[model samples]
Target chain A: MKSFLQPEQWTMAAASHWLLVTTVLLSVMACSSVPAPVAELAAAEQAILTAEQARVNTYAASELAQARQKLQDARAAVVQKDMLQASRLAQQSKLDAELALARAGAAEALAVNDEMKKSTEILQQEMLRNQTGVKP
Target chain B: MNYLKRSAPTAVAAAMSLMLLGACASKPATPEGVINARQQLNKLQASADLAVLAPVAIRQADAAVQEAEKPTKDQALSDHLVFIADRKVNIAWAQAQDKHAQDQRKLLTDARDAARLDSRTREADLARSDASVARNDAERARDEAVAARTAAEQERMAAEQARSGAEQDRLAAEQARNAAALSQQEAESANAKAAALQAQIAALNAKTTERGLVVTLGDVLFDTAQSNLKASSSSHLANLAAFLKSYPERGVIIEGHSDSVGDEDYNFGLSQRRADSVQGYLLGQGIAASRITTAGKGESLPVAGNDNASGRQQNRRGEVIITDAVTASN
Candidate 1:
């Protein structure tokens, strides 16, 4: 019984070693041919530019700054030869910039709507006064 | 399911391997952050306004949510996916909110325009009312001025009439004053004449008889059987002429008388000549000839009998009679 359990334990250990080694070898081979996330980095840079053109910093300052930081981190990941992480970071940076732009647009739209409502209210009050004063 | 269906060499080996791989080999539970992100995405997708407004962003968020939901061995990769998914969902919702506000702007703009138009119309009406009020005030002022002009004209006419009436009254008063002065002068002259006539009658020693006032001239005034008056007797006859002239309303008759003892025709002639002399003297004294009448009487009537010579002498005389009497002031 001891001998049977011993052989089974040895087989499990060897199989685990083989699986680890194959995973490492495949990862190394994949890394040697993988390119930098050039398109994603460009897309993120373009999104940041669009947000700046939209004046996102004035309304969503923290969000725009986080997007810039993410872009820088993405570039660093590319130099470290971590293509998958670099791609994911570039996508996150673009989304961050997009988020900043979206939040700024919402804030500006809300402010404009508020001003329009206030103007309408003032005109309505003025008209009310005119009617009441004359007719009363 | 396929691995479970395959026959194993021993029950113990299959059972131990299943137990050892149970915690890790089973499908990984989704992370709490990823679940939250998916829930948020689901909520946004349920909204028709959000889905229509931000379709592209919603689709991107869906993709990120799916990626985060993927079973992975690397926790860091899972966490990054969850982070991106969370941001993507928020961004989509924010974009949808902005689009919604933009869409609502149309209604707000329309309302504001309507209010502005109402205000402008009311202002135009107010301007018209103000113009009407101004016109009324102008008309009132014009009417007031016309009334004032008419009143002033009436006052001017009244003043002119009063001035003319005052001038007429002044002229009448002046005429009345002139008439009163003339009447007073005539009355004074009448009074002076009456006083002088009274004085002349006293100097002549006129007697009031039954017939009239008579001034008697004695026989001594003329010479015996002569028609001429004596020079000393001329003084007495002069008073008679002045009295007659002063009382021009009175007339006098001069009568010469003689005694019965004288020759009848001779006495008559002598008496008649004596009266003629007295008349001639009065004519020279400025008395009118029509005011004097003279006659001669030869003893036709006598106051004494002819038995005594003194009686005959007293009976021969000349007399003057005044016919009328006039009171002084009347």
Candidate 2:
């Protein structure tokens, strides 16, 4: 007994299989391509985070330096027998140092939260593309 | 069926390419952006609150500082100092009043002492004046007593002389009576003459008024301004004395007068001398000196005016005014 399927039908079925295999490979390649830029973007984001932390630390250090200078001036005024001016300067210096330290902590928290939100948005877009087999 | 089978793979390939492109284009929102937007909203709210309250707060602070400094700079401190000074002035015034009262008391005491001394001096002077007046009165009384005693002594001496003269006349009358008895006709003539004299004496005693005999010697009694009696005036006085001797109780007054022709003082002296001459003749005839009073009333009491010689002769005549007691005794 001989086979009944034609040679052209066999060629078409083989081409279809080849196309599915190529799409799967391309998708994986696209997914692999995302890691190089994503890795570079993550490094850039990390650098930006370090720069922001440095700016916050510099602001905190500058405020602490100004507070220390003011405290010294207030002590000098007290030595000169000017209690009213000394008390006002001491209170202003303490409030400015505390506000600068709080603002530095808030900037560091905002940087870390921004990095997590970018990573989650990339993951959710990948999931939606896999389930629908369509463009976003 | 053939056409559907020919387009199915191509459609799936296109859908897969679109899904991959969409996945690559998606971007995520960051927390830094959300926080920056919230901070900007809070800064706007703060600016609005500051705009509402700034002008009112500045005005309130300025007022509070001004009120705190007002009490230390007031301007009336000098008036308070003056009020305190017046208390010391009042004390000085009280002391001055006390000193003035003491001075017044001393002045009054001195005035009283002066008045007492003046009164004592006046009383001493009055006592001396009264003693001088009393001495003058005593001297006047002594002079009056001496005059009265001299008048009484003169009367006593004249009465003694008249008694002695009367005894002598009695002896002479007795001798005349004896001589007349020797001749009878002579004795009868003497008795008749004695009887006539006795009747004249009785008639003088019967009269109660003033009475006396007026014998006018006329111009034959004396020369001009001379007090001598002529021999003819003497004989008439002798007869009058003889008649007066029979009546011892009868008194005689001899007076002289002068015309208004000479000085009144000289006429008075001439009249007094003429009266004394007549008194002397009566004494020679043995008339008692105690029974005669001699006086001169100078040309003052005149019976006639001195315009004619007859009137002047009448004014120059003498007069005798005998007292009633003497006539009654005669």
Candidate 3:
């Protein structure tokens, strides 16, 4: 029993090793086989990320500039003895800066989710090829 | 598994926080609402300023209201002042009219008093004139009475003078009648004396003429011897008577003679008786008695003287007187 059990253990160990090896190999092959498309996909993703970051930066800059201009108008109204108009302009500039900050955060989160979906589709194609013993 | 669990919880928490933040940020602040809030604040500030200046603002509003109401009050005051002025002028005019009426009454009273004085003076003058006329009438009546008395006196004097003249005329007529009576007596005496003288002459002639016997009786007839009528003488006387009868118409007067004797009265008595005897003898001879008147002459009327006896005888002789003559033819 021990002998039999030892042979089975050895076969299992071998199969397990084979499976590990095949999986590794298939992963390597698959990796190697789609390497240019992956590289193009990564470049497209980087370009989308960069365009989103620049849009967020532009929004942030416009909001900060409006805030700065509102503060300057407030100071000028106070000097001209128009305190009521100055306070109204200062409150409107604060609200525009907070809306620009929220739009930048939502654009960064949508780019990260697009990268995860590409990874999961590649894993599912490899498993099907192994089962059908067909060349994907 | 630990990483998945931790990351999933964290991601859910993060998603919830983002949604809440987005909702909070999405509501936009409007500029119109800010402007409305500012206007409300400005109005509140002005209300506060008005409260601080209340005393000055209220005084200014009151002054404006007083100025707007002034013209209406001024118009009413002017109308009342004009009414008072008109009343004062009317009172002055009425007083002047009353003064004029009083002056006219005084003038009329003065005129009436003067007229009464004039009438009294005229009546006094008339009374004086009437008194003067009555005095004049009394004087004229006195003058007429004096004239009547003078005329009566003159008439009485004239009557007295006429009576005296009538008495004087009666006395002169009585004296003339007495003188005529005396002249008639003297003529009668003269006639008697003439007859005696004629008888004496006649007796002497008879003795001469008759021639009878001469009886001488001369001596005897004387009274010496008593010659009275003797008886012889009677015869002689008778003879003489007879002679006288022859002459009848002749009246004879007788005479006697006487001688110187003792007394002349005795002698004259003897001569007177001789004459008487002769007359008686002649009467006896029938002679008419109315033819003869006898008277005695006495001795005073004797023609002869008485001294001698002859002369005495001559004176004593008787004589015859013829007193009347008769015509022989008748």
In the range B89-117, model 1's lDDT, one tens digit per residue, is: 99999999999999999999999999888
Most accurate candidate by TM-score: 1
**lDDT score, candidate 1, position B29:** 79
Backbone clash count for every predicted candidate, in the order shown: 0, 1, 13
Off by over 4 Å in 1: A1-34, A76-83, A134-136, B1-24, B152-330
- Cα lDDT tens digits, model 2, A34-93, are 212222222222222333344645535665555456555654544444444445455434
- Quality of candidate 2's docking, in CAPRI categories? incorrect
User: What are the candidates' C-alpha RMSDs?
Assistant: 14.8, 50.6, 65.5
Listed in order, each prediction's TM-score against the native is 0.62, 0.26, 0.25
For every prediction, compared with the true complex, DockQ reads 0.56, 0.00, 0.00
Preferred candidate (TM-score higher): 1 or 2? 1
Ten consecutive residues with minimal summed lDDT in candidate 3 chain B? B83-92
lDDT of 3 by residue, A72-99 (tens): 5644543444444444444433333333
Q: Where is the poorest 10-residue window by lDDT in model 2 chain B?
A: B83-92
Q: Which one wins by TM-score: 1 or 3?
A: 1
